[model samples]
Each structure stands twice: as C-alpha cells, then as structure tokens.
Target chain A: MASDQKVLELNDLNVHYFTPRGAVIAVNHVNLYVKKGEIVGLVGESGCGKTTVAMSTLQMVSAPGRIVGGEIKIEGQNIVNLPEKELRKLRWSKLALIPQGAMNSLNPVTKIKEQMADGITAHEKISGAALRDKVLKLLNDVGLPERVYNMFPHELSGGMKQRVCIAMAVALNPAVIIADEPTSALDVIVQRVVAQTLLDVKNRLGVSMIMIGHDMGLLAQMVDRVAVMYAGNLVEVGPVGSIFEHPYHPYTQLLIDAIPSTKQKKPLKVTEGLTHDLRNPPPGCCFQFRCPFVRDACRQKPPEFKQMEPDHFVACVQYN
Target chain B: MGGLTRGYFIQRLLMFFLTIWIGVSLTFAIPRLSGSDPTTAMLLTMMNARGYVENADKIIAAYKESFGLNDPIGIQYIRYLWNVIHFDYGFSFAKFPAAAWSLVTPALPWTLGLLTVASVLSFIFGVTVGSLMGWRKTPRWLNNILPVSLTFTSIPYFMFGILLISIVAFKLHWLPATGGYSRDVNPGWNAPFIKDVLAHAIMPLISIVITSMGGWALGMRGLMIGVNNEDYFLLAQAKGLSPARVFFRYGIRNAILPALTAFALGIGSLIGGSILVEYIFAYPGTGYTLYRAIQEQDYTVIQTITNLIIIITATGVLILDLLYPLIDPRITYKKSVAS
Candidate 1:
C-alpha cells in the first residue's frame, strides 16, 4: 500500500524474445511490487510469461531474449542498463534466485558446501573457517544435516536438493529472492515439506520474495499476494484472499475453476481456444478471443486494471 | 555418493588384467596361425634368395630346438604368456640375438614424448577454442573466426604431416626433413641437443596439433552449447560470480567431462596411430622401429611392439575408469546406488 515500504518493484517491465521469425512479447508492461517481509505469487499456465518476469527481474534472460523496456528496482536501485561490473555486485547480495529444476540446479561436480559457499564468497569476501561456519549454518537452517555439506547433488534426494536451493537463496540475505516454481519438480509429500521450509525461512528472515509457480493449491498456502497473468498480461493483482475468493478477470476465474478439488468431484474445466500467436497478439484485450463475455469494446481496445476494492485490482471490461 | 568402493577397485583391476591377457593371447595365436615356425620361414626365404643352401634342413632343425619352436603348442603358449608377463620377448629374428625388449625400450621414450605432448597441446588449444565458439557470451569476432580453425579437422593428420614436410622441410628448407635431430647434436638433456630435438620436432608437432585440435574444438563446442543451457550454468550466471569463474568452474568444468574421456581414449592408441607420421619423418620412435621390423620380417620385434601397444591402451582405459568419479561426481563406482 506504501511505495516507501516497497522492497522490490517492476515498473512497466517489458521483455521480448527476438527469434528469426519475429519478436514475441514475453512480459508486457507489467508493474508489480513486493513489500518488505511478504511473499507474492506469480501464477499462470505454461508459456504465460511468469518465468520470463522472474528472469527479467534478475536481468538474466539469455541470448535472443532481451529486456526491451522497463526498470527492475531493488531497494530503489534500478537494475536495468546497469554496467556488468555493478550488476554483478547487486546480484546475490541484493537479489537472489532459487531457480526451477532443483534436479539440475546444482553443479554436479561440486560438493554442496562449495556450491553454497562460492555464492557467498562471490558477493562478500569470506573464506576458510569463517566461510565454512557460515555455510554449515545455512545447511542447518534448511533442515539438512551437517553431513549434506560434503555430498554431491546425485547423492541427495530430490526434496533435499530443493531444500539446499532454498538455503542458497537465503545465503546472502538478499532483499528479494525470485523462486521460480520452487516446488514444481517435487512429489506431493516432499512439496509440503519444502513449502514449509520456504515459509519458515521467510518468517525468520522477513525477506520479500516473488514466488513463480503454476500450482495454485501450493501457492494458496504460502503467498500473501497473488498476481494472475495470461497471454503475457497481468489480469489481476491483489490480496491472495481477494483473488481466490472473488476472481475478477474471466481467465482468473477459469484458472481457479480448473484446480482439482477433493470434496466436490467436477469435470475438469478447460477453455476451448488456444492463445493467439505471441508474435501477433490481437490489438484488443489479450483474452478477447477466449473471454466468454467478449464485447465490441473488448474487441476494439484493451482494458486496464481498475481498483475494485482497497488493495485489489482487476483488468477487464466488466470490472471497468 | 561417498566414493569408490574397494570392491569396485578390485573389479576394475581384474578387468584390466583380463584385457591384457586377451591381447597377449591374440598376438601369440596370430603367429602360430600362419602355419610355419619362424626357423622354417627363414630357411625357406634363404633358399629362395640363393636357389640353394648346404645342409638347410639340419640348420633349421638346430635353430628350432635352440629357439624352443620345437615344443608343443600348449607348452609354447604358456611359456610365451610367462615371458610377456615379464616383458621378455626373447630375440629379434632378423637382427639375430638382439633382445626384442632392448630394441623396444629405446624407442618407447621418443614415441611417448612426441604423442603425449602433441595430444595434450591439441586438447588444451582445441577445447579452449571450441568452448569459446559454443558459448553465447563469446565475442562476435571470435565465433565468426573459430569455424575457420575446424577446416583443418577434415584433413587427415598424416596427410597434414606430409604436406608440412614437403612445404616447410624439403621445399622451404626451414627444418630437417628426416630425422629426430641433427647428427652432430649428441642426444642428451643439454641445451644444444634439446634445441636440435625440438627444432626437428617442430614440423611433426605442427602437423599433429593443427590437424587434431580442431576435433577437440568441435567436440568441446557441442558440449559447451549443452552446458550453456543447463540450469547450473544459468544459476552460475545469476549468482553474480565473475565471468571467468563461471566459465571455468561451472561452464567448461562440467562440459569437459565427456571430452576428457574421449581424450583418454585418443591417448590409448596414440603410438599405434603415429606410425605414418613417424615413417614420414623417419623419427626414431617405436612407430618407426615397428615399421622397419615389419619390412624386415622381424617377428619378435613386431610382436613386442604390439604387446606394448595393448598394455598402454589398457592402462589408459583403466586409469580413466578409476578417475571418472573424481572428474564428474555423478559418475561413481559405488554399489547399491545412493539416491
């Protein structure tokens, strides 16, 4: 609610992947913010640009993918266009990443201790016993045993690897940690344990985070705020309660409906149409082709988010 | 995993010995399979040369007895295996009474010095170039120019050696065309001898390195491309470590595992493959010695060289198998498999 309290801000962030065919807009003018000591979930289907947003925030989109516009401000410092030397300093210290694919996130050739310690040493200059003590403490914090320090990634279970990533994310005490699908690759039982570890780490450290995942059920338990995205557009950004209880956008409503429920057996809800070619998105609303309540106004022009209630915003003609 | 187990070590060692035994057995069988003892083959050749020989049959029988060729096949095989175990390949038939091991031992160092140095140099140079070419972060000028180096890969190395000898040695007269060193420089570790040896080695070294490095580059380039896309590589960049650190520790370090295995296999046949190069330059290496032995029908010397090659190759494979876990932690010799 307060700009001064914002720990991380994405202002008009836009990213485009320039393929030989054409430029595909991956993240489009999205503005999101994470306040101190809160977790925000970025939710969408596959290819909806949730991961793109996280990667762009870290300034790490590889070749052929460019952050064409906008600023990623961490602690009021704009990360875009920062020189490589300065950017290196800001990374891990100010912003860290808990990458997806916990299975392969670790360097297979290195020990867990080296993998975790090098990131700290890269940001700060600590070595020898002092560095060793810091890394051991990190392992302890993640509910991993001290013996895990010497083990390789192949030696650890998938869940343990995920926990190690969580520990690494918090290693530098970064202001914001972008965890892309932190629990996507784990099984249900391990997912709960990892999710709990994430919550525990956040509670103890009070660091802001942007958690990227497609699992609505898991996100509902961990995040304080939710940002719903579709076709590279943020359809709704509000309190998790508001987004889950009364989804404003048509797509958001469909997403909530699609989640499998234990108590009530229902036919799985799936939309009939596919997203338009990202290279040539329609001129009007991104969801115009798929929206059940499409109108002439929706066909001619895109709608912007309006404040439906305090701390609640939705982008749709009906909301307007 | 914790590490290689004792059981795994013993298993690999047994496999190593098995390979050597098989190789030695094949060498022994091939000579016998020709269906004539060395003594009889030599006498037959002598008769063909002069059209007559006085007491040829008596001489052949006496030679076979002395050489132990008169023994039964089973006894000879066991005896040959025992001798090979101690590296004792009795005598060169053409160069009478010259111990086969003595001839081979003198030539081993030259082959080792040349091939080991050349392959290692080629690997380092090619891998460095290939990794740069494969990496997206490499400068545009580099990626553009790196492919030109691979043009040499299509040229067989021995052909390249011949070309170098003609152009740089015989034509240009910049280096000696046919020898390990000049006759005047005594073959020792002193400055003059070392200088002469290196000067004579330059053309051969150039031919081997320039032609073979491209293969390493191409292999490493493909590997680096795969490594570039890996999650650990991306995370390495995200961690904000210096570019050099990321490239060496995370990028090349992981990608080079498969390349190292290939390199070791390359070294296994190093000496055997260099015969043509050695013949072209008349270098005093085992390859040259083996070539001359084949021309002169030196059975014991040829057999000794073949056995040495097998031993060297098997040793290379054995060392690679044991060190694989150390280079790539994912590959382990442990049993029961850790999670």
Candidate 2:
C-alpha cells in the first residue's frame, strides 16, 4: 500500500505483561497494515493476543502490560512516542475504539447524552444545544431515537446498548475505529444486525477499521483482509478470500477446517495436542506441537514470515 | 421524566416518615415495656448508693405525679410523640429535674462539631488516597497505604481513644485531657473560646478520625479496584480522557456511589455521638449526657436521646435517597422491570 493510502500500520509490535512469576509475551513482533476505508479482521482464539493488538493500536493497555517495543502509526504519523497530551487530542477524533461487551461498556450511572457529550466535549468546546444536536445525529445514524438520550444503560435493551456504543465510537467521525468483538455479546439474530450496522457505519463514514473477533465465518463475510494469530504470533495474513480459500499456514488451514459446514455433516477437524504454556513458550513454531507436518527445523527454531503468494504472508517452514 | 422523578420523591418521602415513626414508637415502647416505674427506679438507685431509705414512698408518689408516670400507657405514648414533634421532652428525672431538651441541645453542637467535622475530613482524605492507591498504574509504594490503613482500623475505637489520651494528655501533657472547652473561659463565639474548644476536641477527633478513616479508605479502595476492572473504565481510558479525568470521572465517580450509604450512616452516628469516646474524654457531648442519664435512671432523657438518634439517622437516609437521582442516572422511581 502507498504511504498516504495506509491509515494504520503496526511494525515490529511487541507487547508483554509482567506478572510475579515472569513476563508473558502477549503480542510478539507482528506487522499489519490497513488501507483507508478497508476493514481488516484480527482473528484468534481467546488469549491469542488479538485483543492486545487492538488495545495497543490506541496505546490503551493497562498496568503491567506495556508495549515494550513497537511503532503504531496513524496517517503517516507515528503515535508510539506521542506524549499523552497529544495522544488525547488524536483519540476519538483521529482514532476511536468500540470495546467488547457493549452491555457493560457504558457507564451505568451515566445517561446516553452525557456519555456522548463526554467524548465530544473532551476534544471540542461543544455543549448544550450544539452537543445535543451532535449526539442526536450520531444516535440517529446508529438507528437510535432521541428518546434514548435521557435513558440510562439499564433502561436499554442489549442491542440498543450496542448501537449506543457504536454511536459513541463514531461520534467524532474518526478516521480509524478499532472494534473489539463488536457483535460477540449479542445473540445470533442480534449479532447479524449489529454486524450489519458496523459495516454500514464503516461504509457510510468511510473509516478504516480493525475488527477483533474469534469467529472466522463472521469475519470472512465482513472484512477485506484477515490476519490469523496463534499463541501471540501472527501465523498468516492475506486477503479474506485467499485466507478462506488457500490459507498458507497449517494453523490457519486447521482454523478454517474447524468451521462447521451446513450443506453436509462431517466429523469436526480438531487440532492435535494442547497449546503451549505462554509462561514457557516453545522456541520454535508455536504450532509445531499441533501441526501434522511438523519438521525437525520447525521444532528447533521459529520460522520467519515469508510471502507465499501475492499479498499472502504465512509463517511456516513449508512456505519458506 | 419529571413525573417519574416526582413519583420517586413522594415514594421516598413516605418511606422516610414511616421509618422515623416506627423507630420513635419502638424507642418509646422499649422503656415502658421494661415494666419498672422511672420514679421507683430512681429512688431505688439513690437508696442503694446511699444505704438508706427515708420517706421513699412520699418521694415515689411525688415523682409519679411530677413525671406523669401514672398516665395510661397508650395516652403516655401519644403525649410522648406529641412532645417529640415539638422537640419538647418535659423534665429529666435522672439529673436534678432539668428540661430534657436542654440536656440534648447543649451537647448537640459539641458532638456535631467534633465527630461530624472529623468524619467528613477523614472521608475526603481517605477517598482521595484510597482511589489513588487503587488505580492500576499507581506506583508500588502507594500499595503500602492499604496495610497501614488496615492496621489503624484493627485497633478498637475505645482502645485507640485511651492510648491517645494517655500518651498525648497524661504522658506529654501537650493537650487538655477532658471537657468540650476550658471551664476557665466562659463559652462564647470569641476566638479564644473557639481555640480552647478545638484543643479539647483534638484527642477525641484524632481517635475517631484515625480509627474510622481506615474503614472508609478500605471500603473505597475495594470499590475502586472493582470499578477499575469494569469495561466502562477501559472505554473511558480508550476515549483518551485525561488521566485525571479518567481517574476521577470514571473510576472514582462510580466507586463512590456504594460508599454514600456508609457516609450517611457515619453522619448519623456522629450526630448521635460515639458513646465510649465521649465517656472516656468526658467531652460534655450527647453521648456523655446519655451515659449519665443511664446511670441515674433518667427515662425522659433516655427516651428523648434515643428518639433523636433514630430521627437523625432516618433523616440522613431520606436526604441521601432523595439525592440519589442527581448523583446516578441509573436510579429512577419508574418501573424499570418492563425492559
């Protein structure tokens, strides 16, 4: 992608969490990029560091979990070294986040209007009529009505709460929005609606997005690109169609294979062996223990990411 | 929305008055139900202490008529309730026949000035420190504050009061050991009088603050830790709200709600005065007056003080309940179950 076209780029990004026992690498050296208005999906199972990537995108990681090393660039400006004061100016305007579990994402003690006003007024001097107008417009855009403005979180249904959260995320018309499992907490029917709303908002606002979720099927339908992660390492990243059709990494292949088919019933394809303990991660390919074609080289040393095909990168000795 | 708010207010007001009524009735009934006449109890206590009983029946009959102890129980209850509404409590039988209200009003200011001010000061200080300690990124050294607060809280209130009195008053003689003010200076609004009052109040205030501040700190710390784990807090941080804004607005704002109940109860107790602390220091507060009334079998004073405590506590809760909607958006009187 051209420099100007790239809205977000993560290069050599490393995040580690320090515990009493030792430091655990939550996000290893990972590189990913998103073009303007493109939707990218970070897919991995629980604890695979996809959430860390989303948090690190905005430098929102909590205590004991530090970036340790990385550069997070937004619109050609590196944000990794930006002071907190400057970062505050950039956030919710240039970049925003739609956190997971929208049910609890909103402060229960606050009304929807106050919640929206908090974000808008933080960056601008809008209040009262102007603020209400801005919040109402955003809420309307998310299919919520003016009545919800005065209502508290508990007064709204789960779907309505999720919409409010989305409205808040896009309230400032950010350039890039990182949505962490935006539809995961909703039921299947509600999830479909919420997922559709997210896509509609992205298209309408023309904002680039990095969506963090564990469902490959949902991601395949919504995202332009999918980056598959395993045990804190990016195993494969490519166009969504290519990832689903011809995944290069063995782990990605198994991940796609695990998705159940509706037309025909087949025994579920289960990956072999247990995941490696993050406290003492294996030196070689983290998936070597589960890979069917594990090699001596794979056990001895980790494989470097290589381009297997046009715009398709994978970390496997076979691809190398 | 306005209608809902008004509804909520009316509902809370009804509950508030009902609570006070029940508390007052119980207070009145508890003494009468003990089945000992106040006059007889007074005479018996006096005689037992002096080892003599001369003209006891005459004194008892006079006391019965003077104190209205001969009235029917139901009539007496009504009379007592009426007197309470007007803040009148007749005369005390426990100490030299002084007006019951006179005994309470004189001590009210001392207890309120001492304990209320100290508790409020401690609450403000405790919450600020506790919230800082609970925030995830605060330095490790801040965590040390928790154990120190816990140790302070573990020392019983009376024990700490005695310790402070012994060390600061007896050993060092740095401060006055007893009374609400220096008797040498007649009570007044002058600077010297105010200074002396504060000097006498310092020991008890220190004891109340040191022991109780920990509970507030510990409670607030636990609350902040829970709120910190909430997704809303993370969302607030992600919004790039300034560290101070996130810490105070999102973290402490929600955490402080649960602490309000404790604060209200503390205010009520402060108004009522801590009995042991007051007795130890002989602070001339309501607590000390109540102690004296108990010893002298002063039924009128006893019932009135008990009713005063109940009224104050119920009123505190009522005020807090009314103020809930202003502080928290989640609370409303509307039937929220339909959602």
Candidate 3:
C-alpha cells in the first residue's frame, strides 16, 4: 500500500438498493484500493455486491439504488459528491468501464465506428475525419481488423464484440478502467486471448484496472492482487500469490480449493450450501452460515476486517 | 434480395385475396342468417296494417328484382366479388345518386387526417413521459400525474368525443360542430377549403388525443421499466453516459420496439375505431358514411365499404410486417437468414 502508487481508493463504502420489501444493503463497509499499473480482482459469486461496487465507483447505479456511505477517491479527487456534469467530464477522460455482456453493449442499429465516436464525443469536441482516424487506431490497437468499423453489432461474433467493448473503454486513455467479467461469455481460447489482450493493453498504456470476475483461476492469471468477496463482504484481500498459496479466510481457502487441477485425478471440491441471501444476512459474519468452522462467538457480532500480515487482510474472528 | 422481396410480395397478395373472400362471405351470410328478410317483413307489416295486400306484393317483387335477391348465394357472392375487384360499386340506396365508394371516399381523408395525426402525437408524448418516469427509479412529483393520465385512457372514446364536442363545439363555439368543411366553400384542393376541413377536425382530434394518449404513456412506461432492467442499459450507464442519453437512446430505443408493434396494429384497425368518433363529430369520414348506409339497409354500399376496409387493413398489416426487418435486423422473414 504505497501512498504514491495508489490510483484509486475506496473507504468504508456501503451501497443499498431500496426494494418494495425494504432496503437491502448490497455492499457493506467495504474498503479497498488499486495502485497504478495493477489489476485488483474483485472475486465473488453472483449477488455478492461485486458488480454493485464496480457500478458505484462510476456513479452508474440506477433508481432505488444509492451509495449510502463511502468515499471514492480517484487520483486524490473524491468523486462521490462531484456533480453529474463535473463527474461526466472525468469519465472516459479519467475513468472508464468495460461492462458485462459484450453482445448487447453496442447499439445494434449503429456501426462499431459510430459507437466509438459516441464515446469520444461524450468528453471531447472532435468529429468527422479526425474522429474516424482516432476510431480506426483504437480498433487496430485492440487487435481488431479495420473492417470492423463498418460492421453493425449483430454482424460481429461474441469475442469480437468483447474486443470492441474493450476498444471503446480504452478509447479515451483513462487512468483507471473497470472491467466487469470481461471474459465470462467467451470460449476458453477466446478467454485466454482476451485476458492476454487486457494485460497487453495495460502494459502498452500503463493504465490501472479493477477486474471483477468469479473465476479465481482466471483472476490468478490476469490480476496482480485478488479480493475475495462472500455475501456482501470482502472475506480476504492480498497479493494473488499470497491469497492463492496461503489463504487465511476459510471462504478464500474454499474458493482456491474449488479450482480444478490438471495433476489431481480426483474431482474438484465443491462448497456446500447456497450463497446467503442478502435480504436477511446472518447476525454476525455474512458467511457464518456457510463456513465449516462457525462457532458461538461467530454469531454474536460481525468480525471487523483485520490485517493478518503486512499486505494480507481477512474479515473472520477465526483469524484472531 | 430480389428473391426475398418477390416472396414477400407474393405472400402479401395471397393474404389480401383471403381477407376479401372472408369479408364478402361474412357480409352475405350475416344478413341472411339474421333470419328475417327486411323487404318481406316490411311488406307483411304493411299488409297487416290494412294497406293494400296486392300493392304490397307488387312492391316486394320489384324490390327483390332490383336487388337480384332471387339469385343463388354463390352467384350473388361472385357478382359482389367481381364488382369489388372492378371498383364499380353501384349507386348507394341511402344516397340514391352517389356511388358507394364516392360517398365513402370523401370522408376517408378527413378521418385519416384527424386520427393519424392525433394518434402519432399522443404516442410520441406518451413515450417521452413514460421513458423519463421509468428511467428515474424513484417516485417523483411527475409520477403522481400518471393516474390522471390513466383515467383519461380508461374513458371510452365516444363519451370523450361527446364531452369535447359539447364543451368546445357547442358551449365555447370554438370549432365547427359537423361536416368536414363549410358549405360556403367548394370542396376543392385549396387553402380555404383545407382550413375549413381542419377547423371541422378539431373536436375529433381532441377526443382522440385525450382518450388514446394515456395507453401509450402506460405502455411506454411499462416497456421502459423492463428495458431499464436489461444489462446493456446498466452497461451504458457504467460507461458514464448521461442519464438523458442513456434513458432516451438506450432505454427508449429498446422499450419503443414493443410500442411500435402496437402502432402497427393500430394502423391496421384505424378505420374500425374511427366509426364512433366520426359519427359523433359529423366529420363526414368513412365511418359516418358507412353508418348511414347501414341504417338505410343499403346492402350494396355496405358490402363495398366492408371490402374496402378489409383491403386497406390487409395492406397496412403487410406494410407493418415489412417494416419490422428495417427497424430491427434481428427479425428476419426466414429462420435460415442471419439477422
């Protein structure tokens, strides 16, 4: 956690969605940070508030959703309170997002070039030939053929659309890019290519990124650090090597053990029980119901996040 | 491309013929199956009233001869179909000197002008309002206005038409009460005639707008609610799009597709709904003329106008089907074709 290396920081962030029944806290008192030229992976099952955190970073949460409490600072400027007009100026120019489901990301009626142009025009004043040249360069940089510019979204394959999304996300050269499950829909080979392309883009542009995905194996290959999330809480956070090799939290251990190994002849281990419902989470630790070593004390009160090592943090009373 | 276009044309033509056949069969059978011959029944009643029975018989015979009522049903159907195909509908019994088509044709433009313009305006307004309300997520002051709009939509068109005519045409004297244009002006393609026709159209337009705008609002709002839940719209927001751009461009574009289908169906049935509005306003549209023909028991006029409505509606549906491919490429004529 070098202060000079930090690019984005989240302090005590909480997000809630107002439903007909009641307000459900999706992200609760989460604290994390990303450094320049680093990939911080937010790994969790569906509805664990991983995507909500990514969306909240950009102030993109829709109605009935609010960031109840938190401070989100990008390059030392707190953006949570920034007016929409000012925030839009920072977006694409300072921060960008690679959203999920690449197939539906681009408008079907519009060509790829025009979609790129829209991203450019949102924060800049360039158009016409100059815009066309810039868009062509972006496509080329993303390893896509120049002909992709003239093709509609429907004409492109899933992998190509994902690449186009990446191209648009990086078109403005933002300092931090958040990719939400960038390779979820792609095939294994395409996933590898997309993963490598992401790292290649990072190396070439020197942009920091927060990549959110559920596959720890994929994250191990692509991210510099991994943050394990379970039931709306960050169960473990540390460098990818440490979290993978010496996982402290029981949830992180289960996730790492769940990954299939080529050397092992036995079937991969599967964690028992469904994810805890966020509506009425357990009284203490959010994952206490699912943890194998849950005790009486674990149900008394939620465990506060404790730094077990210089860079490794885990939120479990067992760590004490 | 040429093959596809030709196939589409052929399909539409087949559908058109089928529609006409159905309309003709219904017109013939409905009148007969109702189980009482108007001429025979009227003649019997006249005889029972102490009128000359011999004179009544002679009158009934002449009426039957003039209408070719003694011919077989199949022969009568063939003659009806032939006259429709040739566009030679005979003079209306209700308007003795005027051809049925001629009687209905003059009214067609007024109905089309009033209803089409009002419907389009209401649809656009409703879609805009609905999209904004659905996209914002939280309930605002504007959400309270939706119930009133729904109330307007729930009211029947004719009742609203009468109410509007009463207030605006009778009480305020702000618009013409009846007829497409003033009698002082010749019905010509001129500015004065056009102005007079539009003045007569005002009441019908208000009625249609008030009665129909609510459905569009509710429909578009519901669609926007669904579209807002789509992953792509959230993606657009994640890309840092302004709320306006995201709602209008992404959310509305997707939501409006369902509304487009509604619009297409409306175009096909436009004449059907215009009947009551046209009659109440006395705006001399196809509906009003058809109503008069029915009241006078003019079978020739009724049959011809029914055939015309079927043909127009069939053509409208064909056009709507064709437009789907252009609006959304994902919809294709053949399953084998790529979107």
Q: Which segments of model 1 are wrong by more than 4 Å?
A: A1-4, B1-8, B34-40, B53-64, B336-339
CAPRI-style quality class for the chain A–B interface of candidate 3: acceptable
* Candidate maximizing DockQ: 1
DockQ of each: 0.76, 0.63, 0.40
Error of 2 at A90 (Å): 2.7
Cand. 3 TM to true fold: 0.87
Give me candidate 2's interface root-mean-square deviation.
Answer: 1.7
Candidate 1 or 3, higher lDDT? Answer: 1
Predicted complex 2: CAPRI docking category: medium
**What are the chain B TM-scores of all models?**
0.93, 0.91, 0.83
Query: How close is every model to the real structure, measured as TM-score?
Result: 0.95, 0.92, 0.87
B252-278 in candidate 2: lDDT tens per residue?
A: 889999898788876667655688999
In order, the Cα lDDT scores of the candidates are 0.89, 0.85, 0.80
Ranking by DockQ: 1, 2, 3
Ranking of candidates on lDDT, top first: 1, 2, 3
Model 3 lDDT on a 0 to 1 scale: 0.80
> Per-residue CA lDDT of candidate 3, range A174-234, in tens?
9899999999988999998888888888889888999999998999998888998887788
Q: Top model by TM-score, which number? A: 1
